[model samples]
Target: MTWLRALREIVRSGLTIERTRLEPLVALRAAAGVAIVIGLALWLVSPAYAASSALGAFSAGAATFQRSWRPRKVIALAAGAGLALSTFLGYLAAGHLVTFLLLLATWSFVAGMAWAVGPTAGIVSAATVAGMLVIITLPTSVGQALEHAAVIALGGVVQATLILLFPIRRWGAHRDALADALAAVADYARRLSHDPTAPFDAKPMMTARSAAAVTPSQARRRPAALHGPRGLAERIRPAVAALADPRVGAPAEGPGRDRAREVLGAAADVLDAAARSIRRGTPAQVPSGAMETLRIDEGDEVLEGPARQAAVRLASLLGEVLETADSCDTHVVPAPARGAADAPPLLRPTMFRLVPVVLRAMRRELHRDSPVLRHAVRLATVACLGYALGTALPLGHGYWAPIASVMVMRPDFHQTYARAVARFTGTLVGVALATGVVQLAHPDAYLSGGLAVVSAALSYLLMRTGYVASQSFTAAYVVFLLGMGGEAWDQTVRDRVLLTLVGGALAVVAYVVFPAWETPRLLDRLADWLAANGRYAAAVVRGYGDPAGQRRADVRQALLASRDANAAWGEAFGRAKQEPVRHRGLTRREAEDAQEAVQSLGQAAMLLETHLPERGARPVPEAARFAEALEADTAQAAREVRARRNPDWDRVEEALDAWEGADSGMDPVVRRGAELQLQALEELATAVDRTPLERDVASSRQERHARAEEEEESRRERDTGPAPPPKEEG
Candidate 1:
């Protein structure tokens, strides 16, 4: 990964157009909100006020387009309120550059650190900062500032009102998340029918869990169909896995295995039906043969032990799913996916209450090495520097520099660089085209306002397509906005383009200088994932040992922890792949193999979870000790991995060997499950088994070779800079 190649990749990615599903009605609805606000402002006040309203309305609408589980109207309102507050405060400090710069730096830092909460929060917060930078410059007097802020908020109000009046695809995202989870399980069943040891990606289930966390208002109104299906989906996964597993369910290459495949096919059909029903809000259309296929005959012995129990359980759960679909309009299920609590299960705090939660999250990221903290530092530095530089330059619209910087900058290397390129390229072409249109057409104030609204609408329409697409129209919208304010198109064009370039450069350089590479932390992420999966697996095993006393809450919490760890590892690995840094502790091949082993370990746990007995049923004395040993061993292994040492599974082995055949009537199913886990763990150890010294030496040799090639490439790049331009143009 040479700098030149990375640079090429960044540009290519930034310019790439993603084909997104177009939501025309939603786009038009958002546009209408902007139009209504602009019309009211123009009729009551002036075109200038209309511009302010449009900015607020459009920005708030834009925030709704971002991926979030919260209600869109709520997002619209919050975005509006945040924009109003930022605009008002920024106005108060606008007279003094020193005060304005201080405020800008603080706001930018907070916006940057908001990533600790989530991308939706971080992106919306950054949007607010961008709004503040530009909108603050408009109002002069205190009274005028208050009026501007109020009207800006009115835009959000309009958007929210439209959403309430004309609800399109209400609760659609939640339905899709649930449907996707069920669909994933259905696909797994189908895959397992062919290959019994197939792997299932956990993303869909994790997404469904995230979607299930609703605000109190959402919980009361969520449809009954969204309730129990997710939990049913969860139960179905393990049952199918256990049934298909040769070790626990059926013998391979025999009539038993054929029966298992038949059950799997029926399960897949029923799961797919349930998924479709949930997605479309219709009754489950279970296949005619599905139920018949699942029902075992009285004398049939195709499935025995844990496998038979799994079949029975899967059939029962699938029945409930079908019943749930049929009765969704009339009744709520007693046992909900989130437990017998809120209908939708997880009740998140209201927006007002989320302030403290977000604050605590940000506090945790205040450490020196935290990526969010580093990003905050970078954001604050670049913002103030860009502002100061823009002001020092002869460019008229100095705010463009910081506005570009704020909007383009992100918490990662790839995005920060890509977005910078996108913004600059978009602004150049967009500003030029808009300026050309204005110069040639000579549109009036009202026409310009209409054009601005149209531009904003176009930007909204294309938001999901790619950053570049939306940004191009966004620049045109700004151009039309300034035209409405009576600015000469020619006078602003050069300044807009130059300032955008300056801001983008500052943002890119800032990231390069204050880098937060994920390459070095690969081992840490891998260890965290291992520890989380271990906890989840141990909790499930413990449930078998102490079913009556087992709090399902423990399993749920461990499940969430594992999901978070898996996501962190996945995101880190993705970023690391694109990074132009040498992987030190682990090679790409080793890391990937280790991840597969880890995922297989989780899947093994899911297989065991299928056969968890009735709460008051007889407890397994052997499992309780094994669970303890598993917990202790994995924790130590995680520490060993972090310390760059080869992990030893001595405790895990001891737990397995400790009481083998001690009790003559011990559960064979539990023992087999333990064996599966042991096999997976040993695979992980094999994957990363190289000694620390050997790993280091091998990594160094590889790094040296890569560095020499990169240096050679860089030397050639400098010598042949002119030849690459034609290729770039093409």
Candidate 2:
């Protein structure tokens, strides 16, 4: 029995190992490098090491192949290949170790620059360039080196081939799982639209929305990952981007479709909320009829237990959706009614008048002495200094400069400093390990190859975990290359340790100088976001429901822009928090209000899309009035934080509610448009204050359904000829 249990465990372990696919490929490629190392030790280096390195590199390439169907992924992979090849040629041309190191450092800078565009491209570029440079510059005979390079190329080819061979079953599963999750979220959105009792907390909504965004990615590359959260975000990144686009919000046309869309949006919000609540140790509940409104599909079956449970929990939140109609303060709030103190000082010459004051204020806020600017300056300086010191160092072989640069640069003081320390420590440890292995094994070709393979495998595992792991793995490869270069393990270890420290120190010094504050940039982004949303809201309010094609396109673009702005705003504010107040261009409360206003606009746009067509043909009087009221409300909301005394939220809500409810009479197009617009506005308002109107909407739906069922029963009874309906047995 014990033996059987042990055998089962062994099989499972092997299966797991095989599943990763990176391990074996790493080991194989490492052997190629190992052969060179052994030959260098014996002065009879073989070409086999090149093949091994190629294979290892190729396997590393395969790791990213998991994201292969995506164009972005393909582009990233291609860029990495190009960068590595370019770095190698540069190293070959220079021949001098110092020159090679400089080229490698340049490669690192390029990689960092690319990172601002995309993460995958940046990492791949960094890794390939660093690796190739090490291989090209390392000590080896011409014949042996050529053969090794060939083998390495072969490895890359094989890795790419392997990626294409098997059907990736995980792709569909991931997609389906994501879809199910989104569907659950949609259910919650629907409840919130009608039910005013919904919790509708912003944090939870954000969280759930974030989670829902992961589906498109999962649908694309479902890697054969045994159920775990590892690499989940990376896989779903693209899908998240797509979901943020509002044009995709086209509601199904026909009866209940508008209602369904409202439901879906609210459900999405609820799912977002529940996901958040779950993190905070409580789960949100769904309202009654939440699930009934959503279009459930078999794709939902793809979710495993946890995802299913999450969906169920999210559904429960719908039951508790807010009933906010009663909270509507049916009062008209005057527009632009500012107090004397609330007004900005009159500018005699406009731009010139405020220029001096603005400049003085900005100088005081964004001074070089400010912590935020100081941090940015330090980050850039550290990167530059790391490069300079690495160029000066007598580091034997490879691109120490680039490696040092990556280790030294950071988003902030702690990260920059911490990375440098980690890099130094990891390098020293790696060198020591390499030296010990060389001494104990006596540099036999087989043994060296084995060690190389082991290092590659370890690197693949460590890369995703964090930079420290990657740093150590890089050191192991460096040692292997040095061995191939005919350097003794002890000398290689000593040189590596010293140069790493030098590079690290230089990077640290650079970071402390000329820090660039990002606070102003964040504010600028927020302002841009606000302006874009304002335009979108204006377009929607003015032209709801009419010519479908052009208007839809405009509204869709606006919606997408608004979502992008929200995302950008969130990221900007999050980063700004690390900086001092002086560096922050916008006040915290002001920023919050801006986000809220944009969100309200989004809701308003949705409402117009829904109700405008139905009510558009009605008497132009009320519609025109509603438009004016909406515009006024929006302007007020935009400047809400800047007001001397906070305006009445209740009055704002009431005006929006009343405007949304105004009848356009029996015109279906106008009625639907109005209803949709109203529903959307109500939701946005309810977000701030749980209005009873939402609840009334939900109850009305229930009554309508009941009445519908009753009518059907009565018709059936009449058709059956009434007397025969009674039980004959009685």
Candidate 3:
């Protein structure tokens, strides 16, 4: 019954689907591309060639359209060449049993390795494998193969030409990415306005940051003058958070609170307007009276001390946001500020490089006991095995098995199992539907071709929604595609269903036998995150008293590393939770607490970085000393996490208490920033301390209960008498 429940859970998870607003547009683009290719092939060539050409065009265009211009050109050419090469190889290997098997296995292995290059290369490689299967199954001579390959290549050319000629949605993705980042910032500000203590959700902002960061850096292209919106958002986040800090004394009630709320609300409106303008490529019109709301009177008695400080900080950040939005709206880069050259380079090329640095990364992974290398090898092995089994068995359309295997297997056990279930179930439904359509309607070549185009478009549209919907459309597309190419649907439907089941089973078996379980790796991932945060905190603290003109490149690097580490830990933890109860290394509560601690540490570091006073501002020696002490304490906490021991917060707490009494005689803004940073550090330390303490308490309680049970058992045995055991032995 337990096993049944687990299976039911897996099925439910696999079936769950989601759709985004962009689906209709994506579907339309894909459908139009395929439809045009099919129309051209039907007009200029035979129906048999039309099917193969349309398939090639659809796959290549779907993969390349969203990329930048240069990459799109490269992908289009590479994908077309891959298709041609695969078709040629298929013709040369057909009917020769040994040669055919060897060719398929070798291609499968190469395709698996192509994933190490990058996603675009991986997509093209998979498309090539599909092309090979299609061409190999049909009888062809050298001349006929050449003609077929040319038509397929021509199809790719058509897609690329359309992109060049139409130019619709140019830079639309980039615009949307930046818009989303601004909108996320506005959302955060609104939340802060309502309750300074409101839980901050950083996931949306992080996702938008990642998207905006993906723009390719090319020497020939004019760089977008301003840094990504993420930088602006990061600079603003701490100020918003500081407004809610009780230590900052940002008025919890009365007229001051109302004024703060009004400012935040108005700022949010301006940000929303900016995002809308960027997305629509129009001039940004600041909301009426928003600038007026941001204006702070110098001598307002009600806004004294911390409230005054918060209002000033909020006004400054809002001004920066407005300037950035105006720059984006006008399509003009802002002039470099005085001493801009001396400022730290915040937007580095490491993340935005056009050519991926994956090869060097893969090489490094191969030198260690890396899960990436293990997964790659496993994928290649499984792909070859699936191909050999399908070919050796008496299954018709044997290529489907290997394709299914390649599509279903992932680096992690969780995804592999989930995808296997989804793929098999989707295949069953798709085959039944396709089979029924063929039997009832007896569709001709033209109808079948149109149906194939529609299904292909739908598959690409729902690709991100989940595996099941995408697979269902894909299976239906394949059925219609083969039918249009003169294969009877009746004969292919059963083979598709059986082959998918076999492939899914093979994928599951492969992972079960040699799983890369995330449970054992969870601790290491968490430790890495802690170490990264520690380094980030240290860098920010060390630079707090540095020359105002100095660049903090180290801080930026550490922040990026910490973000990457956090993401890695989150992925590993999520997979670990989905494993069986006995296999889970940490409880859900323990993981969540640790995650919160790491996030708090990151927030503290950001606060310290932003708190550093500008040139000519008063410096607080006490603040600098406190920051250094906090840095050392954070490092110690990281070491403790690595050692799987409780963090010692006693010394850190004492330092914080001592700092509270020390008078720095600094400006209110600097003092408030320092207070917020110190408070955040304390929160982080407390959260870190709670994890091991809770675990110890739970352990002690369990031990006491066990001891009580043993005592009860002894009493029961004494009452029953020991003579019964001896009598049984005699």
Which segments of model 2 are wrong by more than 4 Å? 1-80, 95-113, 139-152, 170-388, 394-398, 407-443, 470-474, 480-486, 501-516, 543-550, 579-597, 600-730
- lDDT by residue (1-730, candidate 2, tens digit) is 2435533443333223333334344334333333333334234435345434543343345345323223222332353345346534653645565665455555544544433323444445445544554455543555555555544544444444444543333233233333344344444344543442232222322333333333333323322121221112211221221112122222223322343343446455544443333322233444555456443345644222222332333333333321111111212211211120122211122222534654454355455445433533443344344545555666653246545655455444444555666677668767777877777777754455556556755765554444455556657756764464345677677667776776666655565454444456654565456455555655565553233323545655665566666676676666555444343225565556545654554544543443333333424434444445555554454454223222232343354445443554433333233333434333423333223664465446446535654664586577676533212233
How much lDDT does each candidate structure score? 0.84, 0.44, 0.66
Per-candidate clashes, comma-separated: 0, 81, 0
Cα TM-score per model? 0.91, 0.54, 0.82
Q: Please list all clashing residue pairs in model 3, or write none if there are none.
A: none
Instruction: Supply candidate 1's per-residue lDDT for 56.
Output: 95
Where is model 2 poorest over a 10-residue stretch in terms of lDDT? 322-331
Best by lDDT: 1
Candidate 1 achieves a global lDDT of: 0.84
TM-score of 2: 0.54
Best by TM-score: 1
